[model samples]
Target: MHGLFRWSSKWWPGLIPFAILWVLAAWVSTVPLEAELAANSGTALKSTVLDKTQISVAGRDVSFAALAFSEEGRRSAVASVEAAPGVRLVNDGTRLVAEAKPFVWVAERDNVRVTLWGTAPLPASKARIVEAARAALNGTEVVDRMGLARGAPARFDAATLLLLDQVAKLKDGKIIVQDTAISLAGMARELGGREAIAAALKNLPEGFSVAANDVKAPPYVFQANKDPVAVTLTLSGYVPDNNVHAALVATAGRKFANEKIVDNLKASIGAPSGFSAAVTSALGALSRLSTGTLIVSDREVKLSGDALYEAAAGQIRAGLAKELPTGWTTKPEVSVKPAASPVDSTVCRQLFAQNLAKGRIRFETNSASINADSAGLLDRLIEIAMRCPTTAVEIVGHTDGDGDAGFNQILSEKRAQAVQDYLVKAGLPADRFSTTGYGSSQPIAGNETDEGKLQNRRIEFLVRQ
Candidate 1:
C-alpha cells in the first residue's frame, strides 16, 4: 500500500499540472468566442428588423435568440453572426415577429369636430396622436377609432403629427394615411390653406409622399354702403392685408369728395384674381349714385340705389358692365331721381302740397334733429324751391299735443329753421325762405290716437304773394 501511494503521489503532481493546462486552454479558447458573439449580437440588434437579442458563447460556438419581423431579417441575423471571427458554429433561435396587415389612418374635421380613424403602430403612438389632435383643434370634439398594428412606416408618428397640423387649417377636410402614401381633400378655411399644406408636406420624413391633394377655398367678400344724406361711406368685410385696406380707403377718399369714410375691414388670405380691379370699378359706379350700396362677393358685384338723373342711371348701367374684369358679374338696381319742372308760384304751391301729401318730414324723438327718412322728401322740396327762384315761400311747422305747448312751439320753430338751413345748403337762397311754428294749435287729426298724432305733425309750404 505504501509503494502504491508513493507512485500515486508522483503521478498525481503530474496530473495536477495537466488539469491546470486543460482549464487554461479551454478558457483561452472561449475568450475569442465570447468576444465574437458579443460583437455579432450588437450588429444584429442594430438591424431595422431585429429586436430582443440574447447571445451565449461556448468555446468556438455562438448561440443567439432574437425576434425578427421578416424572413429576410432572420436570414440577415444568421449571416451576420456566422461571419464573426473565430466562430465555428452558430445556433440561431430567432423567431419571426407577429404578422400584421398594412396600416391605414384617417383624420377628418368639419367645423369644430375632428375624428380620427384606423390603425396605429403602438399604444403609445395612438395616445400621443389623440392628445396632439385635441390640442391642435381648440374648442372642438376629437374622436378616435384606431387599432394597434405591428408594422409602421418609417417616421409614422412624425408624419401623422404633421398631417394633424394641416387638418387644423381646414374648415372641413379629411387626411388619409395608407402605409407611406398620404392624401388630403376638403375645403380650406383660408385662401392660402392649400399652399400652406403643400409647403408643410415638403418637410416630411423619407418614405412618405402625398398621393393626392384636393382642397377648395372659401369666397372672398368685400362690401361698401354709401349714404349721401349722412355724407359717409362704410367699408366692411375682409381685406387681404393692411396695405390693401389702406389703398382702398385712399381710393374712396379720392373718388367721393363729400363722403366721410368708415373702415371696418379685417385682414385675411385668398384674394380673388381680379379683386382690386373689381372693387375699384364698383367704387367708380358707386360714386355716380346719390345713395348706393356695393357688395363684392368674390367675382360677383352688386350695386343698388338712386342715381342722380335718368341719363346718369343709363350710362352707369352700360359702362360698369364693360369695365368689370373677366369672369365677373355685375347687378345694378338704380333708379333715377325725377327732375323738378318749371312752375309759377301757384303751381309751385300745388306741387309742394302734393309732395308733402306723399310723405311728411320726420324729426328725431324729442328733438329738432331731422331724421334720415326725411332726406328724400327734403331733396324734392329743395328741387321745387330752386325751380321757382323768384317766388318767396314760408315753411310753417306744426306738432301733436303730446308735449307742453311752449315746448312743442320751440321744437316746431327749431325744426322749420332746420329745414330752411338744409335747403340753403342744397343751393337755394336763404333770403327766399321764411320759417314759423304753430305748435299743437292746428291739428288736422285727433290727438288721442298714435296714427292721428303722426298725421297731425306736419310742415306746410305757403307761397308768399
Candidate 2:
C-alpha cells in the first residue's frame, strides 16, 4: 500500500503541470476566435442594408447570421465578413427585412388636373394624400392611381404630403418618391415658385433626401401701349422688385415725354436674364411709333405700331432684333402712315398748333436742358417745320412763377436756344427760328398747384409773316 502511495504522489505532480499547459493553450486559441467574431459583427451592423446580425467563429470559420431588407444587403454583409483576416468559411443566414415591396409614389399636374400614381405604404396614407390633393387644387381634377406596398421609409406620409403641396404650386410638373429619395421636375406657376419648393424640402423628415430638383420659373411678361389721339402711354407687367419697378417707370416717363404714362407695374421675383435691358430697347422703339403696342414675354418681343414713314418702319423692323439681348426674338408689325399733302405757310402754322395742343415739349428739372421724353414730340414738330422751310417762326419759352424772375427769364431764353440747337442739328435751317423768352410775368395758369405750375410752363411757336 505504501509503495502504491509513493507512485501516485509522483504522477499527480506531473499530471497537474500537463493539465495547466493544456488549459493555457485552449484559452490562447479561443481569444483570436472571440476577437474575430466581435470585429466582423461590428462591420456587418454598419451596413445600411443590414438590420441585425449574429456572428459565430470556430477556428478560422465564420457563420454570418444577418437580417437584411434586400438580397443585395445580405450579399454585402457576407462579402464584408469574408474579407476579414483569418476567415475561411461564411454561412449566410440572412433573411429579408420585409415580405412586401418598397413604397413609391408620383404626383403629376397639368393645366387643371392633378394625377397621383405609384405605391403607398399604407391604405390610410393613400387616402390622405388623395384628399390633400383634392383640397389644394379646388377646381382641378385629382386622379389617384396608387397601390399598397408593405415596406415604407420613415416619415413616408409626411414626405408625400409635402410633395403634394409643392405640386399644387406648379403649373405643370411631376414629383416622384422612391423610398427615401424624392424628385421634382416641372414649371412653376408664379415667380419664386421654384425657390419656394426647394425651401420646403428642407423640412423633410430624417432619412429623406432630395434626388433631383428640375423645377423652372414661368416667363416674365411686360406690356406697353401708346395712344396717339390721347397722347398717353400705358405700361403693365411684372418687375423683379421695387427697384426694377421704379427704374422701368422712370424709363417709360423719359422715353415718352409727349404721352401721359399710366403705370400698372407690379413687383415680383424671377426676372429673366437681361430683363431691364430688353424693356429699355423696346421702349426706345415704341417712341418712334405714332401709335403702338409692345409686348415682352420672357425673351420674346412683339411690337406693332404705325410708323411716321416707310423708311422709319423698315428701320425699326430690321434693327430691333439686332438691338435685343442674345437669344431674344423680335416681331415687328409696323405700318407707315400715308404721306400728307403739301401745305402753304398758313396751313402749316395751323397744323403745328393742332399737334402741339395735344402735348407739350418737356425740359430737364430746373434747367434749360431738354428732357429725353421730349424727343418724340420734338420729332413731330421737326416734321412740320421741314414741310415749310421758308416760313419764319418765333420760338418763345415761358416758365412757371416758382424761381427768381431774372433767373426764370434767363432759363427760358437758354431753353429757347436749346430748342433752336436741336432743330438745327436735325437738318432744319437755323435762321428760320427767332428765339424769345417771357418769364413768370406771362403765367398761363395759377402757380398754386403742381398741375397749374406744369401748365404755366410752356413753349409757343408763333408765325412771323
TM-score of each candidate structure, all chains considered together: 0.51, 0.64
**Candidate 1 residue-wise lDDT at 269:** 79
Q: What is the number of residue pairs that collide in model 2?
A: 0
Taking the candidates one at a time, how many backbone clashes does each contain? 0, 0
Model 2 spans with C-alpha error above 4 angstroms: 1-103, 228-232, 241-264, 272-281, 299-301, 310-335, 341-347, 354-358, 365-368, 383-392, 399-414, 420-457
Which residue pairs collide, candidate 1? none
How far residue 304's Cα lies from its native spot in candidate 2, in Å, is: 3.3
Residue 141, model 1, lDDT: 94
Q: After superposition, how far is residue 201 of candidate 2 from its true place, in Å?
A: 2.0
Q: Highest TM-score: give the candidate number.
A: 2
Please provide, for model 2 over 1-465, each residue's C-alpha lDDT reduced to its tens digit, 9 standing for 90 to 100: 999998887787788889999999888978777686668656655744454467877776777776665677667777888777667777778776544444678899998789899877655677898998888877789999876655888788888888888998899999988789898899998878989999999999889999999998887889999998987899988888888888888888777766799988888887778899888888878887888999999889999988765556776787688788998999999997665566678988997797667667789888998875666667677777877777888999999999799999998898888898888876678889999999778887899999999888988888775
In angstroms, give how far residue 446 of model 1 lies from its true place.
59
Among all windows of ten consecutive residues in candidate 2, which has the lowest summed lDDT? 44-53
After superposing candidate 1, which stretches have Cα over 4 Å from the reference? 1-102, 227-231, 240-243, 266-269, 305-313, 333-465
